[model samples]
Target chain A: MTAIPVQPIVSMRRVEKIYRQGDSVVHAVDQVDIDIFPGEFTVLSGPSGSGKTTILNLTGALDNVTRGDIHVEGRKLQDMSRTETSRFRRDRVGFVFQAYNLIPVLTAFENAELILSIQGVPRTERSARVRDLFHAVGLDGLEHRRPSAMSGGQQQRVAIVRAIVTNPAIVLADEPTANVDSRTAATILDIMERLNREMGNTFLFSSHDPQVIARAHRVISMQDGRVVGDERRDGNS
Target chain B: MLILMAFRNLWRNTRRTAITLFSIGFGLMLSLIFTGIGDSGYGRLIEGASRMGMGHVALIPRGYLDTPSIDKRFDVPSDLIGRIQVMSRVTAVRERITGQAMVATANDSAGAAFMAIDPGTETPETLYFMDFLESGALFDPKNRIGIVIGRNMADRLRVDIGGKVVYTLTDVQGEIISGLARVSGIFRTGVLQVDNYFVLLPIDTLRDLIGYTSREVTHLAVFLEDHAASRSIRSRIQACVDEIPGAEAVTWRDAMPDIAGLIAMDQSSNYLFQLIIFLLISAGILNTILMSVLERKREFGILLAVGISPLRLFSLIMLEAGWLCIFGLIAGLLLTAPVYGYLHSTGIDLTAMFTEKPDVGGVLFDPTIHADLRPISLAVILTVAAALILLSGIYPAWKASRVMPVEAIQSA
Candidate 1:
């Protein structure tokens, strides 16, 4: 009998990104290769300036690679135009940032359902999905409150719900817990883990927090714009 | 949802928004009020000039306007005058003999233009003699050869009311003629040229002096109920008058191109003033929108990263500007309405500004200035302000939309 190999959801081969400042050229993201698969709660762990956020940006098509190929869901991101790249990000991926950047004018429910709205989902369906996600993230009664009225942990929970409400193939979080308290960070990680397990959603996060590193099922460590280690813990470590 | 967001965002900085609105609203009100006053003042001046001596339309011998002499006189039959008086829109028609002459008293003499008017046939509303009568009565039927002279001319000739004066001029056959008349009234029109040069006498007496027949006259002035209808009335009267030999009709616009030019210049300057006001308002709006865009750089980046397109962001910014302009427009109209009402009803007294009635051209303007707002002018001003506000938003919106999401998010 022959074995069938499953393809990775995101593929990067020899990706490089360079920046020119005045008369100096710097390699912000050097030659590197990685693959992210489905239903994995993975962490990219590195010190400052290790190119972790750059790699995540490249995968999300928010930034372009200088000299290599990047494929998200088996399609080459480099081949897309700027508009197409934006559409790709809109349709295929969700993002969580460190600042909990919800639109100030929108309520919690509105912030969560914005992506579904953008996708032209009917009003009823969008409301139902946002309500369910809000419930899952323990934000059921705070739906009408704006970000300014919510606590830091509650805001992050809303951001998480926003990221996953569209049910994209992956959620890329850049330092998502960097601004929250330790207890709030733990709560955020627990919600992410449960969502990853139950809804079969993939999460790729960049963080140096030890608590985040300890909860990840897979940790890819990087140093000086290059991957130094890849470790997988067995059976939900 | 976008509109709601834009509206709410405007009030996030309440002080800034209030200041911007005040600037736009105040500027617009000032522009509208000034424009209304200017238009009303010009309208009064034109109407006054037309009614003073030059009627809205006039009939003259074809070549007489170019060179005024006794030889260029034409006969206007009484039947033609009766026909013109019965025409629609023609209020009155009066015949006059205008000629240059030398007027002399016992002590002094000066060159003057004499207009011989038939006082019995002329309308009191169209005659300047009664309005400016400084002393003595207007021409009396008891005194057939009575004359009315401007005060400046009276001063030049050193004559008073009831004083005897002699007027001399050349007649139709190249013969010099002279006539003796008593000054029945002395009038003072505020217009310097009219006061300095004009002398009035009975038309029949002047005709007898100049050797003209009974029906012959230099010109006939036609008055109209609506001054604005002058051009069309002139054209209608011209069609009939042209059949008479060497007869032509002229509208006041053609008779006084300098006054028409003055009106055009006033209108153009009003438009320029409006432009300046709108530009100032646009600058205020542009500054507010640009600062809002700058402060929301990170918010815009997050929006882009979450799938909102740059074009959508641009529209959002422009929507904000549109809301602000609409608020400002409503506020301005509301604020200006009562002030305009007051000015239109009661008028502004320019007596404090000018000690005497000012004469523009040959027309004297009253000291009380009333404002009149035309609907077309109001619509034009509002439309221009709205357009300028929208135009001011484009650049800031474009700048906001063109920002790269990643760099924006990374920057503080």
Candidate 2:
């Protein structure tokens, strides 16, 4: 008997991105093609200036691709208007920034529930879901604390919980553990790995951290705006 | 949640919000105070003129305004007087006869305005003469030929109280008439024209001297209970005048167009001054809001990345500006209330500020200026404040909405 191929959740075909500064044109992302399957804990690894963050930005629809088609859940991103793209991101994708960019004025619970609020979820359901997620992320008692009052690791955990509280199709985290200590980074990785395993939540990360790269189920390595190595690992190893 | 965010955002920088509030509050306070003082000053000017025998309404002969000759006299309608006297709000109606004449003492001569009034019927308050008398009575019922002269006129003519003077004018038959009259009283109203040129006589004596019959007079001055009710009262008097031939009722504002124009100019200039103040306030608020929006570019980028549309972001910025303006308006009103109350009650005395009281439309003004609070004026000011705040918010909010998440997050 022949095995059926699993359909990818996000597909990129010959994606290219170029930037113009003054009179010079530079290729920030070359014709790179890749597919990310559902429930895959993937990492895009590259040195500085190797287009890892650029690819993350493109995949999340934070920017437009110069020449190529990118689809999320089989919906073409290039065909959407600016407003439509925003709505698509709001409903379908979540993001975690390297800086843990929580709103300074909002408390931890508010920051974590912001995506759910933006999605127009009811107050009661949002409260319940955010509370459960906060407990799961080990930030149970710090719900009312603002970002400035929290440590770097705690802020990132809030960001992580915020990213998944809306039940998005995928989460794109850019250097999620870059600002934390080794112990905190390991904790963050453990939490994200558990969510991926238990809830079938897909996560794509851009990082240069060796620890983050070592835990990924699939690691796509890039050099000079092009993917040089694509490695896939089976369960745990 | 958006409102909560906006309100929290405003206080994130306490000093900036305070300064913005102070600026708005100060501007509104100045506008209120200036409006109050200006209205009070203009109100006094109008009142002074109205009390100086212009009254609230006047019934004049058809051609007397165009030519002040003795031939322009109209016969006084007794029934018309009875009808007007019975009307509500009508305080007094007095007969008057005015003509240009020349008066001479033994040593000097000057041109004078002769005003013939019925002392028996004319109220002293209506003429505003009882309080301003320097030496003698307004008019004595026993003295038919008694004349009242202003202090300045007395000085110019070199005449004293109880002195005899000769007045000469052309009568209705085009014949020259002369009369000898005794000065019974002298007044100093501080109005240059009235003090220098006015001469009052008994209406009956002037009618006889000018060859007028028993019921002939040049005009009828109508006084009202409240000067502000002049427009409605004038309409009623106008209807009565229409029933009588060769009579027309005119309000004080219509009788003195130049003074009315002056008051209008004063109001318009006050509005212009307030506009200038509001412009300055608007600029300050605009600067503060724009700076805040610029500083929050990265935050706006994060908000956008979380799927807040550009329009929503714009609304958030505007909401912040609205909160700032509301705080400012409240602070301003709170700070101004007590000061306004004190000024309204005690008034600002200009007696020490000026050597001579200001005069307009042949009437002397009181030196003390009291603040006037009218509901319409307050409404206008509040509306202007609201508009200025909204106008100041537009550019900053638009700029915030236009921020691109990619560039904003990546810039720094």
Candidate 3:
């Protein structure tokens, strides 16, 4: 008999992360169970404080679970040290945020080089990867431009390039299109989708935007720190 | 690349960068200025005092400097001066007799400390006394009654060169000896102390006039090749003196405790000023770094949101501050060269501003300032400035890295 696969790329088994605020405990992520497969585009949607971002953070290994096991690629989050978590983030996860946190002092190419540089990639290879990512994000000639000089849409595109430049196992995008116009948001979604299909990479995001939700292969609805609905789409690829 | 980025950022925020630079620049300038003034003035004072008849190093009868009594005189051997002259480090050695006396002429009388020297064995500074000849020649040792009067003493006595001056003093036997000497030379040394109360006479004549039977001497004045080698040379001389009976050696610093104390006090004051300047620069740098980091809270949160570790973010802030420090150093160093050069050549004269003069141990104070580009001072300043700037970034960077991405995004 063939052995069954045991764990997903990112899986949280009844995970809960609570924070203490003065006198009361906040259920940032309460009894949340999640499994994100390889090569899948998933979206977690909710209102403010609904624990969508917390779940994404836990799945990305940016935060440790308070109660339950959070495993990424068969490695338990509880067992990982701070350095190991940082390595996991460095080599196993990528992130795109709504604020497009590209280093303002660094140019588009330099910002993208952050992850690659820290991973000890050679300068030649890092430069090539940065140029390719900038081209892929439709910012081919803007590699030398700083984030401050670029428009909101252009900066967001550079942020996407920075997130994916390391070619990690999973990309976590938290409201990546919130800062851009509808047209630019569509293009950003299309690039992410194309990258997902072409590179066979996994992408997971948390957003309340309808456009972001419509583009996902799977949608997980969250309310009050718990998943309310899980829906999968089989077609429209 | 971080350096380049930091430079651009500093230029972009020119006003803020200028404030930070000024903080560092003013600190550098203050240290240079005060230290320059002190170094220049003290150096002049020491050199002036040493050259005014006394050499860089001196040898005196052991207990005579502490309590000068005729009984404490040392009978230096006739061959000892010749032996010291052969030593390579010995520039010049002259025997001298020093005593306190009341000198009088027909019109006036003044109390003074008299230094009697062999005019033939004179150094250039001997000219500070004998060169301003009003009439007759300076004292010749063959003539026991020839004396050179200082200009101020001459004026007080209502006498000039060729006039006769009367001197009465109690001899070593406690008997009063009265005599008259012809004023052979009249001179004006620039120094106030020497011009007012000093009277130069031939050593042999003074000895005979004091009625000493043996070749007993008050002190042996020594000048060295290198002033800094005084301690070692003094020790060597002391060793030699130890081999011989009834001899002692003393360095100029030991010979003059008050002068040494004056230099120590100036050095301590400079150290205190340096510490205050360092603290001021540190506070300024801390304020700038803290403000910069606090302003970029949302930016740092976004960086963490995109998987940049908090440690790396912290390093980035430190690197930025380090780069700023380098800029400040470069600017400060560049500005130092011309200012130091100008001040070194033409010292800031404060004589016009202050009518009341300060004296450092008997030496009059002057404001002529100078600074040398010492490697040690430069290294110390650079290290301190950089450290202050780096230390200023820690708390702000930590606070920045802790910014929550979710909250930052929501707020944005």
Q: For candidate 1, lDDT tens digit of each residue in A1-237?
A: 998886888888898989889999878788788888888889999999999999888888888899989888889998998778768877888899889999998999989887788788999999999999889999989999999999988999999998888888889999989999999999999999999999999999999999999999899999888888888877433
Clashes of each: 0, 0, 0
State the TM-score for model 1: 0.80
lDDT of 1 by residue, B1-412 (tens): 6787889888989999999998888888987898778768876776677665667888888877678777787888668888888889889988878888898999898888888888787655678667888998667755667988889889988899889999888999888888899999998987778888888889888777788898998888888876677888888888877768988998877767778788889889888887888887898899999999999998898888887778888988999989988998987888788888888999878788875668777777777877786666788888888888888899999999998988988878
Which number leads on DockQ? Answer: 2
Per-candidate DockQ versus the true complex? 0.54, 0.59, 0.42
- The clash number for model 3 is 0
Please identify model 2 stretches exceeding 4 Å from their true place: A1-8, A115-122, A235-237, B55-110, B114-127, B134-148, B154-186, B199-253, B264-272
How many clashes would you count in candidate 1? 0
Q: Largest TM-score belongs to which candidate?
A: 2
Q: What is the interface RMSD of each candidate, in Å?
A: 1.2, 1.0, 2.8
Q: Return the candidate ranking by DockQ, descending.
A: 2, 1, 3
Query: Model 3, residue A93: what's the lDDT?
Result: 83
DockQ of 1: 0.54
Clashing residue pairs for model 1: none
lDDT tens per residue, model 2, B219-325:
78888776667898888888877866887788888877777899889889999999999999999999999999999999998888878888888899889988987
